[model samples]
Target: MSELLQFVFSGITVGAVYALVALGFTIIFNASGVVNFAQGEFVMLGGMITVFAHAAGLPLPLAALIAIVVTAAVGVALNRLAIEPARGAPVVSLIIITIGASIFIRGASQLIFDKQIHSFPAFSGDDPIHVLGATILMQSLWVIGGALAVFAGLWLFFTKTLLGRAVLATSNNRMAAQLVGINTKFVMTLSFALSAAIGAFGGVLVTPITLTAYDVGLALALKGFAAAMLGGMGNPKGALVGGLLLGLLEALTAGYLSSQYKDAAAFVIILAVLFFMPQGLFGRKSTDRV
Candidate 1:
């Protein structure tokens, strides 16, 4: 039982991070109808930027804030520079563009930050808290708390704010949204910015526990993408559920089976979910309009 509890605790921590990344994917897809494969790059930037900034004598909190803001700006720039110019292109083109952008960012990170793994001090002291005979690190709590906070904030923003409604309207139908006075372009830009900010924030929160390196983004992106797919690509609720489920499965697999196959666990689950329900857990089925 203690062993099981341990796995669950660890899984939830990692799952929270995955959930945040999945949320980023959902936001961008909903707004632009394009999957930003570069989503993980934002996370990489958050951790890498904060590491450098803090090393250069900035406070950790300030460095994190700057990282989130800078990543958000980069997201806006990505929309204007890459996605905007190629708007209305085939889905394959958009996918290739985002994948290319991610590769470019990874290369840049390797040059700027080098290939060494780096991490920072946790927000709280590195102490373990025991719950139900399972010990969890203080940083784990921070990550979980951060994820919940983000989810709550997003829920409020989407339900209670005018700008959020405009974004939703644009996602529903870009042409109709524009006709109704919503600036679809601005909505697109805002979606990218917000999505990037969320991804970066997750990186900042988890870096202390996971450590980080220039090349970590791809794996994170893949897992998050899988989580999004498992939950239903465009559904925020799906993203959250899928992420947590994937994490728990991985954890249990590693604990009971083999740690070496931890990564494969997620893919297995994805395959199983796809086989059983192609639309994902929360995804709504749709028919093409002929």
Candidate 2:
């Protein structure tokens, strides 16, 4: 029982990170039909930048803040420089562009930051608290808390804020949004910034536990993309559920089955979900407007 509980706790922590990454994917996908493959680079940047900044003598909070800001700016630049110019390009072209951008960012990260794994002190000391016979780390609490806060904040922004409504309008129909005086292009930029910031924040919160390296982004991107697909491509709620489910599945597989195949579990589930429900678990069925 304790072992089961331990796996559950670990799963939740990992799920929180996956959820944040999925949220980032949803934000950009909603605003622009293009899936930003470089999204994972923001996570890598967050963790790598924070680690270096903290090592350079900055306070942890300040280091994280800098990482978020820089990553947000990079997100904006990516939209403006690469995606925007390639507007109307083939989906294949756009995918290549984003993937290329991710590779570029990873290369840059390697050059700028030494090729070493780095971690910072957890927000709270690494104290373990027992829960139902399972021990939980304080860092895990921080990761879970950060994920929840981001979800709540995004919910409020989308449902209550006028700016968020503008974003929603843009997503629903760019032409209609422009006709109604919304700057759809600006909305796209904003979405990218918001998504990147969230990804970076996830890195900042989880790095103490996961550690960070320039090459870590690709795997994270793949997992996050899977989570987003599992939840329903553009549905925020689906992303959240999919992420948590994937994490739990991986954890249980590791605990009960074989630790070596934990990574395989997530991919297998993704394939299974797609095979059964092509539109995704929460995705809406689209009909052509004749």
**Model 1 lDDT at residue 4:** 99
The reply for model 2, stretches above 4 Å from the true place, is: none
Name the weakest run of 10 consecutive residues (lDDT summed) in model 2: 265-274
Per-candidate TM-scores read 0.98, 0.98
Where in model 1 is the C-alpha error above 4 Å? Answer: none
- Best prediction by lDDT: 1
Q: In candidate 1, what residue range of length 10 has the lowest lDDT sum?
A: 265-274
Q: List the residue pairs that clash in candidate 1.
A: none
What local distance difference test score does each model get? Answer: 0.93, 0.92
Error of 1 at 20 (Å): 0.5
Estimate the lDDT of model 1: 0.93
lDDT value, residue 124 of candidate 1: 91
